[model samples]
Target: MGAVDRYLQEQHIDRYAFLPFSACRILQPHKLRNCGEVKTVLLLLTPYYDGDAADRNLSLYAVPRDYHLFFRELFAGLREAFALDHPGASFHAFADSSPIDEVDAAAKAGLGLFGDNRMLIEERYGPFVFIGEVLTDADIPCESGEVRECEHCGRCACSHEVCLSSLTQKKGELSGEEKAALRNHPLVWGCDDCLLACPHAKNVEKTPIPFFKTDKQYRLTHEMLENMDEEAFSSRAYSWRKRETVLRNLSLHGE
Candidate 1:
């Protein structure tokens, strides 16, 4: 089947878009242009917003399974399929660990552009989606999709003066003032308030079905983290520091 059918069946994706990227060419030189070369770009889309399911705790992204783990496995499965078809071909799936610039590559492939909010925007999924791509030697297909721009959005300046990503990764312990930032940080692992403030995202369909239809609400509760020991807490999401770190952040956030 083609990339379209593959995305639909394999991914169980009701909604998706494919954008071909020239990441290999960007990385390689002028000489080895086509010498036994094979490569294709694959983009996967996942929705992570749950409406009205409020905990008022934990960052938006870390509420679910580790995306790095999920993306790595999914990309590996894709490469395995490629190897089966091409036999002697060599292939590998690059998670975020790759040196290639992912957001830039995706935008070049016609996925979308990075808005002033510093997030990729598409007509359907907006900015709440995680992007993963596969690099290979087998030549795949490409298409010209919509070019969505984010220049006019003033929310980034008016709001989100501080980035949530930087907030959580804020080194060691926190003081009175630093803890306040964590509470109003918008998210723990990542932030989407800029997207949430988008007028475009407001009118789009409400995450369709199973995307929002899950009892499998990925969330990290205070109680869940409170009981965990140093090792156990570290095993889960948002446990980036000693137990004191989360407690301090939480205490400040709750206040």
Candidate 2:
């Protein structure tokens, strides 16, 4: 492995698998061979904590700036920077999405430890973080090491409760079982019980940059959605999903 690749592997990729919450994935040289040769995986960290995020109107990811837009520009800059030095290879960026398992890739990258709740927890933000990856055809370095395990800590009781995001995503009236989960659930939007439960969340140092700070917190309130158009609503970290989905989630609260 080259020096650049070695440094990233030891520092970031190495922690991918260990974190209870992280985005873990590998770029297939073969996959990129078709494109350019699959070189480096550009990794990014987005902090979603604001010191106070409970009983919020939106999911944890939603309250912040739309990461999809934020990171696209970020990764593009990285590629441009790398291209200046190593113009021999090409790259691709992905903040990924709900449909893909980003946390799992973080684990594989050795960037953090994994919790039983299936989230990747880092030493700084715990599991309340967003990740982006850039797959490249240039050979750099890889963090193939395994992450330390954090599966059985049982320290945080958030995941055990019914999750609000799950309920809301269902897009309809919740069943008695689902409602029970919500009453006992830790959050109304994205799940944070597991995040709050992690030991590393409280005292981590803040990033020097301001872009990583999320929206602080924003719930999918009825008034906000009812009054605004989809274009406006889509601007938030909250994905531009349909209004009915959020409405059903709010219904669980009977408000």
For each candidate, what TM-score against the reference?
0.73, 0.73
lDDT of 1: 0.56
Native-structure RMSD, model 2? 5.8
Candidate 2 lDDT tens digits, 127-207:
766777665666654554564668576776553444556665666566788877775544445665566567766686554
- lDDT per prediction? 0.56, 0.57
lDDT of 2: 0.57
The TM-score between candidate 1 and the true structure equals: 0.73
By summed lDDT, which 10 consecutive residues of candidate 2 come out lowest? Answer: 13-22
Off by more than 4 A, model 2 = 1-36, 53-55, 98-101, 108-110, 156-163, 183-186, 206-208, 212-216
